[model samples]
Target chain A: MSNPESFRELCRKEIHTGPTSGVLPGYIQANLLILPKCVAESFEDLCTRNPVACPILSKTEGRPQFLRNHASLIKQGTFDIRTDFPRYNVYSRGKLVQQKNNCVNEWSSDHVGFLIGCSFTFEHALEKAGLVPKNVLYNKNVSMFRTTKFLDSAGIFHQCPYVVSMRPYKLTEVEIVREITRKFKKTHGEPLDWGYDGAKRLGI
Target chain B: MSNPESFRELCRKEIHTGPTSGVLPGYIQANLLILPKCVAESFEDLCTRNPVACPILSKTEGRPQFLRNHASLIKQGTFDIRTDFPRYNVYSRGKLVQQKNNCVNEWSSDHVGFLIGCSFTFEHALEKAGLVPKNVLYNKNVSMFRTTKFLDSAGIFHQCPYVVSMRPYKLTEVEIVREITRKFKKTHGEPLDWGYDGAKRLGI
Candidate 1:
């Protein structure tokens, strides 16, 4: 569990089938998305425009001859998209259809994969900065809420609201929090807005 | 040529099937994209993040049981995505398979559509401001070039470069051009950077 490569091997063999979060400390954990290439353009564009919300770390090569399953190189070793994830949620028409441990059946020549940056990376930095957010200190999941402030719509991803991961911090520590987070652009950098006015602006 | 409604009608009837650009002056023109809903999330995410290059104006509603063909209400009247575009290019695995006048044979219930903001809308405003871009003044198509500045990759749309539309302007007219485009947020607000230094920064 200490070594990410060995952990990934365990994931491939289905021996360690649980949430990968908090397991790989000191290493960057990525959020993965696998979908068909046809609809990927718009998604990539949206992520590029909204980096704070959706920062991309790595992605699979867009090749026409996706004849074979891809073995993506993460940090230490190659990880197959279909089998590497602890679990997979199959969404159909924006609804969850099924849950699977692996996606060997679902992944195809047309499918593409992306590795999005996780906020956990910055949380590590925040802890180092001594401005640890309330949720982290409490060892609780950062409370998330759907705000009225909608993101720019693209294709069928319309009416997509800005989902905020709330982590309360002292008023005195806000500037330090901003400074620490501002350094990590790939991770959600800096507070978009702070305080009650900020909350109102975000429509939280 | 004047009324957008009549123009759409002409497109539907296959009477005036040509480029829709420069025809409907003073009207907001949009770029269209149609794809399956299953892969739309990533595409939409990419578009949302990179608004300047990909300004999304409107989108089809994401719904389950997409049983029938959708007749979308555009600026003036209901225009079907299949027949309204004047032309359609069928791409499979990122390769052009064929060209069609309509997508009636191709479009299915799983497909989703998006209307992206076109630069032509701002061109109209720019002309009104008495500072026409070089492409418009000489009646030439805006020469667009791909820059080395890649966007934040999402899903399969990785290694996507920033394709810039080049237009020449005098040094004195730069700030005014910036001011003119600044007001149009939905249509690429202001210059990301300007001049040779700007071009260098964008990696042009």
Candidate 2:
């Protein structure tokens, strides 16, 4: 494993395990997608088609190296796909397999990397606005739901519902929430709709 | 009059005579507001209170000089307050008197310069996302209408209706438009309503 002091201390030994939020402050955080190069191009096209759902930050054409914007987050050559992330889920034919923290041995030559814009940037903006993120406050993952809304799909892009992340806010702050989400298109732009009904419809 | 060559040329010769759009492209463009210092604190408070309507970009606490953000566009310590703009309207006690180009000498030391966020940023983001900004292409100002919605007001804010800017697109882009608008709380975030009849009630 590539030896970066922080990585070695926190993740390499399997001690630090959680969603990679609040890990590196002030730097852009990202969502990861690993796919075969054959399917990567089509997926990228789909992202372009429905950018609100898939704001593309950066992508690796052939191998799953960190994209340029995310390069600063790489600790060392130690990006042991298997052990680097606190946790990862393996997928076969679009079906998720056993969850693992590291996948060095499973790493394949044909893998390509896609990094997407995350809510971190907008969340930072929100914090600056003094609207504390309740999920972060409560130390829980922002609730995510699968929506019946279909993202524009391309070749081999399954016509499946989109997965959305949501948070609750006061009725008075609905306008504020609407305003903040407009800025970060790379993140899902805004809620598909408001209220628990919207959540239930999305199968949250 | 900081004597930056480019800004100097634009200001001195009045070459920068336009709506001030796309100038100093990456620099933040501010919507200019000049209010008497006597009313400044209350107005500032109003901005603070109704952040969506008035995103406080930068303010001159007492006088309009040393104005923030768009300073790069000023020339030789001079910004042509009157002739530099494409158009201008004079309002006394919130009443319109004349529409002219510049209001240079008419400005008083008591006049405080307020720069709030404009719709340009969100429009740029929308265009970047392959969504269209029809108003720009039509070469007209984005439609500004009054809304029945009363913005939460402070001193001079007075619970007045809001002035909303609209850029029309196909009905299909409703979701995309909503999403894009949400990001721009510093500006007006989303449309008060998607359609016009409702927006027209306030004499927009």
DockQ for all models, in order?
Answer: 0.09, 0.03
Candidate 2, which CAPRI tier?
incorrect
Best TM-score among the predictions, by candidate number: 1
List the candidate 2 regions with Cα displacement exceeding 4 Å.
A1-9, A66-82, A196-204, B1-204
Residue B95 Cα positional deviation in candidate 1, in Å, after optimal superposition: 1.7
lDDT by residue for model 1 (A1-204), tens: 677677767888888776553556567777878878888865775565567677777677753212123333344244566787777899887899998888888878787887777767778777777767666676666777787554444433444666766778878877777667665667665555568766765557
The stretch of ten residues in a row with the least summed lDDT in candidate 2 chain B is: B20-29
Interface RMSD of 2: 13.8
User: Model 2, B39-128: lDDT tens per residue?
Assistant: 887677656544556778886544444555646644434544334445557897779988665667678776877778887767677767
Which regions of candidate 1 deviate over 4 angstroms? A1-204, B15-17, B62-77
**lDDT of every predicted structure (CA atoms):** 0.67, 0.62
Q: Candidate 2 lDDT (Cα, whole model)?
A: 0.62
Per-residue CA lDDT of model 1 for B1-204, tens digit only, reads 667767867877888655554557677777778878877765775575567777777666653212123333343244566777677789998899998788888877788877777776677777888877677766666767787554444444545666767667887887787667655667665555557866765557
Q: Which model scores highest in DockQ?
A: 1
Candidate 1: residue A57 lDDT (0-100): 78
Compared to the true structure, candidate 1 yields what TM-score?
0.50
